[model samples]
Target chain A: MNYLLDAFAWIADPAHQAGPNGIWARLGEHLGYSVVGVLLACLVAVPAGLWVGHTGRGRGLAVGLASAARALPTLGLVTLLGLLLGIGLVGPMIAFVALALPSILAGTYAGVEAADRVAVDGARAAGMTEWQVLTRVELPLGMPLLIGGIRSAFLQVVATATLAAYVGAGGLGRFLFLGLRTQDYPQMLAASLLVVGLALVADIAFGLLQRFATPAGLRTTR
Target chain B: MRWIGDNLDVIGGHLVSHLLLAVPPIVASFLLALPVGWLAGRVRWLRAPLLSAAGLLYAIPSLPLFVVLPLVIGTGVRDATNIIVALTLYGLALMVPATADALRSVDPRVVDAADALGYGGVRRFLTVELPVAGPTLLAGLRVVAVSTISLVTVGAVLGVPSLGMLFTDGFQRNIMPSILAGIVLTIALALVVDALLVALGRLVLPWTRPAAAAVVAPTQAEVAP
Candidate 1:
């Protein structure tokens, strides 16, 4: 359509690519927020999920918490936090981390829990300590699903980090918001394309990562 | 509590709008996804593309979708129609794959038995395959319902009337009580809906519940090992 072509023209324009407001710079800010937020969520969630999976306690609690967390509206959370924290990067970052946590936690827990019980018993019977079994046996076997969780989390953070714009933290969302206000349809379309494109690229890259990270023995012939 | 009491009528109105916006999309998507899912399940080659498309749709963030939907669909920026359309897409994204997987999971033996009993393709699918796959289908529906209910709140960002309006109003006024009320109400709504779906699933598929409990007993012992 002509509109898509116009949007492509906007993307191709040198003027839009060179300034502080350039797409590249906005992308960097967006990635910066997303990377930091996902890392923070992983730091907190992965370990907690692994512990719960390893101990086989609090599975219900973890699931309950994750589900409840998933149901919280992200925009509302970001804006509410912004109101309390004065609309800085902090509020959006908190929202991003919160958004990513549930997926990662649920994925990790499900992956570890779903590991073959026979293999886990074998490791323990081989005189391996609990920690050693977890590190050596369970972790590698569960790597695929753990990566799957991370992949979903990463994509979610990248997608949702656009809300950073709402709090005055610059990201790809700035284009869409500004375009909306100015009634610039092409610009809005272009920004959406970028977000969709970024999400697809991340998803494909993670899909590949999951394949590589999966142990050869565990790989099923689909 | 006091703030909610004072704004009871406003909250009530928005809640009705929220349900109106969410429920139709869910029902519509389920109906639309049924045939698509059957096709995906029946045709091996179509499975990858169909599921990948759903995944791609799911990866799109709600905010961008909200902002750009008007351009894609020719709706007004602030129209409730935009929210309905976006939410319908989301429901389809989730339910399509779920339906495909559920149908694929139907016991082939049962289908064969139905065929042996002189049931036609459509009749077998409706009576046997669907009933056999009921639990998984219901589980997927429960997830979609809860997610749709939560996501309806995001439409508040564009000022479509929903419980999300409470969030916006509370934020603009810097009223924590109002914001908390919105958050609590949304979560409570999700929980209640989720519980209702679970009960509905049990009522509709009484056979699956006993089988589910039987499977759980062994899993508990496996947990210790």
Candidate 2:
């Protein structure tokens, strides 16, 4: 189809591959924002999740909050915050962090909760302190789930990072919104293809991480 | 508040239009996924491939799908049908897996018990597996409902009218109230619809215990913008 060919040709264009507005830069910006946002989310959510999971309290609140959080619209949050936070990266990053937080938090506590109770008991019974039990028994046992949540967060942040262009931030969304406004279907298709490629790569990489990261005995389920 | 008061009609219209774009996909995908999900659950060889396909579909970020679907379907880029169809695909992504899981969770012995009592495959599925799977299926439907309603807002980026119109319109005009109203209304719509779903679930499948329904199943990553 000409549509598909034009999109392929558009990406193949040497001229389109460079400049501040180029595909490579947009991809970099997108990855940069996603990585930073996800890291920020993990830092905040992981500790809190561990606390709740290890202590077994506040689960009711966490579940309610995460579900409510899931209902909030990503674009609505981005636009609202982007305007209020004075455009650029400030607003979108904040919103992205917020959006990514719930899943990571849910994943963390859920993973920790899913830890083998017998192993935890054994760790405690064998003269390990509470902190030692948490670190030695639960954390590694729960790595797959925590990583699952982290990847979910990573994917979410990447999606929001794409929408960053709407707020004067730079990313692959630049191509997307630009093409949308200009009716450049090939350019739009090109951006879509590039994003799909990134998603597949990330998915496979994380799939590998989630698999090998799991302690072999624990890898049977989940 | 005065802005809301002044634009009540417009807000109401957008709300109506938003429901139009959001509801059918939930219904269509729920109905469409049942057979696909049932088959995927029933067949040994199909589950992995079917679910992986769903994962691939869900992995495609929503905006890209919105743009690409028109190309595949020959709809205009801005067509409402594009939003409807996109939302349905997303619903199927979440529903198919949930549906399969739900069906798989049904106790095989209970199904056998039903079979011993003169229930045929169709009758047994209706009498046993579907009822057992009801709560999880409903949980999945609720997830679909919430995410689909929220995702519809993204369509406004391409100039469709919905509550998201308020966000875009508000942002362009630097009107905080409009954006806030949009966000609140969209969330409100989700909650209200979710409540309706809970009621509907109870009405249609009264056998599912409230205790089991208390645990809201974790929704799989819908992979949205």
The best candidate by lDDT is: 2
Candidate 2 structure quality by residue, lDDT tens digits, B1-225:
999999999999999999999999999999999999998998989999999888877766777778778778898878999899989998999999999999999988998899889999899888788888999999999999999999899888889899989988988889999999999999999999999999999888876757545453332223332
- Candidate that would win on TM-score: 2
Q: Number of clashes in every candidate structure?
A: 0, 0
For each candidate, the DockQ is: 0.48, 0.59
> lDDT value for candidate 2?
0.88
For model 2, the superposed segments whose C-alpha errors exceed 4 Å read A220-222, B209-225
lDDT of 1 by residue, A1-222 (tens): 677798899999999877799999998888788788889999998899899889989899989887787678776787788888886788888888888898889888888887899999999999999999888888888888899888888887876677657656788988877887788878988887888788778888888998998888888743
Please provide, for model 2 over A127-198, each residue's C-alpha lDDT reduced to its tens digit, 9 standing for 90 to 100. 999999888889998888999888878877777777667777888888988898999988988887787777
Ten contiguous residues minimizing lDDT sum, candidate 2 chain A: A158-167
What is the model-wide C-alpha lDDT for candidate 1?
0.84
Q: What's the true lDDT of residue B26 in model 2?
A: 99
Any idea how many clashes model 2 has? 0
Cα miss at B170, model 2 (Å)?
0.7
lDDT of each: 0.84, 0.88
Residue A9 lDDT in model 2? 96
